[model samples]
Target: MNISGIDLAIIAAYFIAVAVIGVVVARRTRSGDDLFLAGRRLTWGAIGLSLFASNISSSTLVGLTGDAYRVGLAPSAYEWMAGLLLIVGAFTFFPFFLRSRISTIPEFLEKRFDARLRRYFSAITIFLAVVVDTAAGLYAGSLVAQVFIPDLNLSVFIVTLAIVGGLYTAAGGLAAVVYTDVLQAIILIAGTSAIAILTFGQFDFSWSAATQALPDGHLSIVRPADDPVLPWPGLLIGVPILGFYYWIMNQYIVQRVLGARNITEARRGAILAGLLKLTPLFIMMLPGAFAVSLLPGLDSPDKVFPTLIQEFLPVGLTGIVLAGLLSAILSSVDSALNSASTLLVLDFIEPLRGEKLTPRQGRRYGTLATLGFMLVAAVWAPLIQHFPGLFSYIQAMFAYIVSPVVGIFLVGFFWARGNAQGAFLALVSGHGVAALIFALVQSDIIELHFLYVSGLLFALSAVLCVLCSQRFGDAPTDAQTRDLTFSQRDLTPEETPAAWYADPRFQAAAVVALTLLTVIVFR
Candidate 1:
């Protein structure tokens, strides 16, 4: 846990360089478009890397390793299934998103349904992304910060994370977020990949040897139907539903895809993001699996990652990895801050004002919202330390909020018979189901796994949507329905790139195949 002067210097320099990038990009900000969607000019590569960076937060890096150490690889389904989900999004959701020419995902709801729906969706997104997800990131980062500097105050780390992430995000907006996220992605991958390699070396360079001390089913991707953590039914049903909500619809993630230059760029960007997702199974998850041998019997699974970095990695190398960990923190924090601001300004503020603000006014309101939300998240973050397990606590809350929304989003998009009344009831009933199940399960009155519980909630919501739509409401107006339904016309242009390898369809299909093959191999 002791930090060398070299490590201290490396970490300090990383922060300064990121701040400089924020300042430089702020000078280019001339409109709301530039702030929120990167002026809709990002290329596939930047978009892909930014998505990866924003998503692979400190919580994921630490929590995945920790979860694997304690409970085997059951939780990895959430990570791996996302690639398949992104493929689905690329083909289905992103087409609608791009064609709508909207800045926020909730705007799509407003266009298809009504402003009330938009505000409702946006409000939920802000609470989850800003309050829950952002606070979790801060808690995880501060947890790691304490490991690095035993003397560091938890509050200090939390506030520092907020100031660094919030200031840059508010100053330079999405363009700065994406560009810095790209840098964070590179550092994070390189640094973690090194640790993964070194971890295998601890077992004489043999995967078999590294996994020898693990629990049964520790390396398996598919668990039994009655598995305690991740039942096979849940893996099949719940994961995809949650994955769709996250990879396709979650504002924190989909915002990057929404910023791509065109349909071609967005599709390619999404595919590229899916490809990067595969790396975590090895770089993040396996390290903890191996740690069951290398660093055995740790007091808490959450401590496994830091223990590995502290013990095995040399000084300069540890510095790079530490920076990568902080990058993860900043990446998620800045992303959540920016997206939450967008939702507040575009969905609620502008609508309530009864007229659109000029670009300058929009930027000002967005900055204020970002700063305010950062304070709230920072204040609440350290409380997450009280949870039983970091990873499960985060995932469990998402199930309550995200599943119902996913049910409504998918139904609203695909089933023209679906109505606003149905959507409202489905959304409301979904959370009720989640709360009821959580209480029952926590009281030891139910044997259902959490993921299965999420699946149950999703199914209930979907059925409620159908029943209510059929009985309670009329069809969407022609104006709202136009170009809202899915069709062949939504695809990217048929013109082939000079190289077949460049085709989004080709790249995306390859990512999907690899994902399926991985699941089968691990199963």
Candidate 2:
């Protein structure tokens, strides 16, 4: 666990460089839009990198790797499935979101449903962002710091990481986050690939032996029909709903798309992100499997990646890997900080005060709010010691909250006959069902993975929204009608750019290549 001087120096250099970038960008951001959405001028490459980096947090590296260490490559079902879902998102969800020209996802809820739904979602998003998302980042970062600097107090590490994340996030907003994320993503990928390669070399074992040692079902990409993680039942009903909610509605992820320069760029960015997600198996999951061969019978699965870094990597390379881990942690934390601030200022504060603050006022409020939330998350980070599994805890909290929001958004956009009453009921009742189910599971009244619970809640909410809308019909108030009809029109050819795959030859080749790669890897 002893970190060398070179490793410490490399980590320090990355942090200092990021801080300088944030400070430099802060001076350029003049308005709330500039701060939050980067003046809506981010290119496809920046957006794509940001999306990839933000999603691949330390939780994915540390927690998912841990899961892989224990369960073999089965946990990678989430990462690999994300590639397919991103393609779905690019085609289906991107069109509507880009057309709406909305700043916040909750704003879309206000447009399609009602103000109450918007407010409720905003509140929930803030709570989750601060409690679950930010705290998780802090906890993971502190764990790494503790490993590298054992004598260093946990509280000091937690506070330092939170403040570093908060300062840059508050200063530069999404612009700095996205730009820095590109660099972080590169470091993370390179460092991970290096580790995986080195780990494999050290094993001096064949794939046959590794496969033999793995438990039955570990190598099965397609689980049994009733398997919990990728059950056949879930494919029929669960995955699409979960996909819609995560790719379309989740604020932390979708914020990157919202910052895209145009629909074409947004769609392209999403597709690119989907492609990038497929690499996690090689970088994170495979390394965990390699770890199983190297370091068996570890008490805590979460220690797998850190333990590997300490054992396998050379001195200078160890520092680089540590930097990559820290980058993953900070990238996610900063994104959460920026998005939570946007939701607080745009959705909650302005509405409550009944006064529109100037851009400067908004920026001030956002900075202060970001700092406050960081403090809260720092306090909450240590509490994760009580949780059994990081991935389970993360998923369980989201299952109850994300479904209703997802349902309301889908109904609002696709179902023209949808009404506010249905939206309200669907959101409230969907969460209610999810909560009750969760309580039952906690009390041992039932057995289900949180993903199953999330899928069920999502389906129930969508059905309820459709049924209730049909029953109530349109009771559109003047404001509701005006908002619904306002700026609603099909984009002309001039307005809508060409699709990402408009080139027929390139599109065909990409599809073939991706399909072949997927089949070969899984086979």
lDDT of 2 at 374: 88
What's the lDDT for all of these models?
0.86, 0.78
Model 2, residue pairs in steric clash: none
Off by over 4 Å in 2: 203-206, 209-212, 226-230, 473-520
- After aligning candidate 1 to the native by TM-score, how far in Å is the CA of 71 from where it should be? 2.3
Error of 1 at 257 (Å): 1.2
Q: What clash pairs does model 1 have?
A: none
Highest TM-score: give the candidate number.
1
Quick one: best lDDT, which candidate?
A: 1
379-451 per-residue lDDT for model 2 (tens digits): 9988897897666678788777787677767667666677888888888899888889989998999998666
lDDT string for model 1 (315-386, tens) is 887888999999999999999999999999999899889999899998999889999999999998878878
Task: Judge candidate 1 against the unseen true structure and give its global Cα lDDT, from 0 to 1.
Answer: 0.86
**Regions more than 4 Å wrong, model 1:** 492-494
Residue 475 displacement (Å), model 1? 1.6
